[model samples]
Target: MFGKTPAKEFRFLRHIAFPLRIFLLLLLISLLLMAALGQYLSASFEDYLTNHVRDMAMHQAKIIASNDSLVEAVKNRDSQRLSEIVGKMATGSDFDYVVIGDRNSIRLYHPNPQQIGRPMQWTKPGALEKGESYFITGKGSIGLAMRAKTPIFDEQGKVIGVVSLGYLVSKIDSWRLDFLLPLVGVFVLILVILLLLSWFFAAHIRRQMLGMEPQQIAQVVRQQEALFGSVFEGLIAVDPDGVITAINRNARKMLGLSSPGRQWLAKPIAEVVHPASFFTEHIEQERRDVLCTFNGLNVIANRGVIWSGDELLGAIISFRSKDEISALNAQLTQVKQYVDSLRALRHEHLNWMSTLSGLLQMKEYDQVLAMVKGESQAQQDLIDFLRGFFDDRQVAGLLFGKWQRARELGLILNITPGSQLRHLPEGLDSTEFAAVVGNLLDNAFEACLNYPESDKSIELWLSDEGNEVIIEVADSGCGVPEALREVIFDQGVSTKTDAPGEHGIGLYLIASYVERCGGIITIEDNEPSGSLFTVFIPKVKIIYGSSSNDSDC
Candidate 1:
């Protein structure tokens, strides 16, 4: 009662090391094949030897029957003559024995003298009656043998006798064994070589697989997919030839690829990522936080190489859209601006409180009232102007904070005459607009603070008189150098040299935001010794009663 199924019985094979398992399987197959081949060759050899011996016996029998001496002896009933002729032919030959019989099947000559007069045993009557020559295997006077029988004919063409030539089956088998021994040795040698090669091949294959089992490799692939899907950043991996090997869903989405990621596989990285130099150039080293453009979208990218020992396999690139980075930057900038405004207000309020306390202590109540009136009127006037001109609350708040910030830094900030904004440009929201304005104004403020002039004043202008919204910020500070003016908006290019990574991204973010909104920004020299930055953004057309807006700005 064999209870175990084949699968259960062979389940232990799963635990074997992959190379060993391969070797064992290959060895088993080779052994089986060689065994079957050996059996086939053995059987074929025996058949060939039997046929060869039979053919030789038949030819020898015919030749003996045709001999005039043997025929004359048999015709004259001379047994002595028959024995002499047959003995000479059989000696030192492959035949075991030769027998001559009369037409009546009486033995005329035999290997044994006593059996010469006896009738030959196992003789077929048809062979003699029909005067035919044939071959058969049968037990005879000596032993089991393969015999050829030929009928002898007289001068008158009448059957006078029969000739028989025989070879012992046992002797033929012994001959076969002797011939096959060397071949068997060769087969064994070949089998050994094959097994060795199979073992080596299996070991080589195991090394290529990094010694991981098939199941483990599959599990790792699944884990990689999960990790790629779960990550927020886009990821792409390339081989040493710069062909894309793996790309995740986020990468496709960020690159605005509509087709499945598989379609991009094996394609050149340059075909998918514009300006792929960040990945292709200096591929041996790791790069971090490198800003680059991918498919026309600004992205913060990092690249690292994959290595096996000292061999460079490929590289993996991880990146996210600069919009996400800009959003974070916008929030941080707002927070910093808010804190700066609070600090500036706190310091100014302290000064006001000290003045009021001094007036109270001196008992100058009239001066205190006048000072309070002046402060309230000035604050109310500025608030009224901002509320009436700027429709967006975020932009209004930003302008107010920058104004206070300028005053706190001992700089005059001016809102140019007859400047107003009824609507922001299309595709540009208040948050982004605030970031753009904030960065420009902060840059101007920094320039004025760093390179102070006698007239350290900054001018802000805004207009939405036509299809485009225009903004200009001019500062009496260190203007951009002629060498840097061309590349000032490029990432990592900045007039400020104090900090490396921090100071260069503001203008880049501004330029990127403006470009996305179909706007243009330009820089020129201010009248005296400052830079004037102007932006013109196309606005969206609004239908008075319709809900939808078109791109007819």
Candidate 2:
């Protein structure tokens, strides 16, 4: 193993970690700045050189044209005299060439003597023919040059010839180099400083990362993937710009996405999660537990800020389905209520048993028989009434629980004899139906407590006829106030004093569930006394109903 390469060793040198990447990023930015600066410096130098060279050339040429010797030579129409004066002037000046051309554009003098007496060739169009002083840059007999041309006029004001002073483009560059050399030195020095900083940062970052090998970093990435994948709750991580950087399978499931790599990653958070408000805020403890209907799932989210040392990275959101929590709570509450109801029934039965035992122990057999028969008939009537709806245990248990609660309060619960409910109603499952029935019965029972024992009674009528299920609950207590009747079904509108997490949600739940399944609920006054609540549910399609195969409570 010592002879072999370490598995975590970097195979290539370009393994830039986060800090190193930052350093490279800085390097790239500095390089771009240098390039832009170089371009600007080069352009400015060329412009300055062009103007300085042109002005100097024009001044020298104008001085030569004003000389008496050049004027006398031109007046005599003497090419030989013109050549001698132009040759001497060119030698004395730093200009590349001082040439004299006749008005017919015949070159009388030039730096290249072989070009003399030839038609003067200027690279630009209309060169020297416009008879005006100007500067132009182009290739001539002496190669590319920036030349100043001025037309020489006779005393009669007629143009006789032209004089030109030319400076090589390369010569202009020599002057340009004066300023550019210092700029280039500064550029190189800055680049060296940048490189030193980059190297220093690279070393610092390497130490911080403990010089982890490529394989080790890859292993860490895999570990992260496994960690996120193994989580039960949804996990999503976003960048500072609100783009999803990482999302787990559970997140995909919660978000109703296609798969892990199907553009979900790196997509903007707004487009991935609906309503955009779910993960927009910097969610901490006080702001955590965001409840939103995102991606068609009711999720309760807890968002935490992600940071790298002192820098803020983004946010990590963990969420669970609200349906899961609700289901668990519902189960626990149902079990507890059922147990309480059964306990109340057992206490009542124990009292009955005590009375029957006392009667049997005495020497009163006929009175005992009459008492037993009366009790048997009442219990049988209650059983028969409940058996009508026993096809669904949820419905049976709900009504049975209500019956026991009424008895504990010493209130009469009357089920109309004309009522017939065969099974769970259409469009609502047993649990849904039970919840609706239970909440109504609880409200009725609470209302009945407002009256004296003699007047304490609740009337429940259930009938399934003509493709509709009708439920009516009439309480013999104070009727609903006329002013509050309109908003009675709204959430948090309970008539009772609210305790923590225990009040004002039942009616809201029932109304929402009714609306979901397309049903109607109404409130009316019961004859002679309290309030009558009637619910009409149409039988169309029952999708959430409990079947015979379902477990019994």
Please estimate how well model 1 matches the true structure, expressed as its whole-model Cα lDDT.
0.86
Poorest lDDT segment (10 consecutive residues) of candidate 1: 544-553
- For model 1, residues 301-420, the per-residue Cα lDDT tens digits are 999899999999999999998867865775587678778887887898899999999999999999999999999898788889999999999888888888888888888889988888
Give lDDT tens digits, candidate 2, residues 45-93.
7887778888999999888877778877877768788878877777757
What lDDT is reached at residue 355 by model 1? 95
TM-score of each: 0.75, 0.52
Clashing pairs in 1: none
For candidate 2, the 10 contiguous residues with the lowest summed lDDT are 544-553
Off by over 4 Å in 2: 1-235, 247-264, 267-300, 307-312, 319-335, 357-369, 388-390, 451-454, 498-501, 542-553
Per-residue error at 182 for model 2, in Å?
30
Q: State the TM-score for model 2.
A: 0.52
TM-score winner: 1
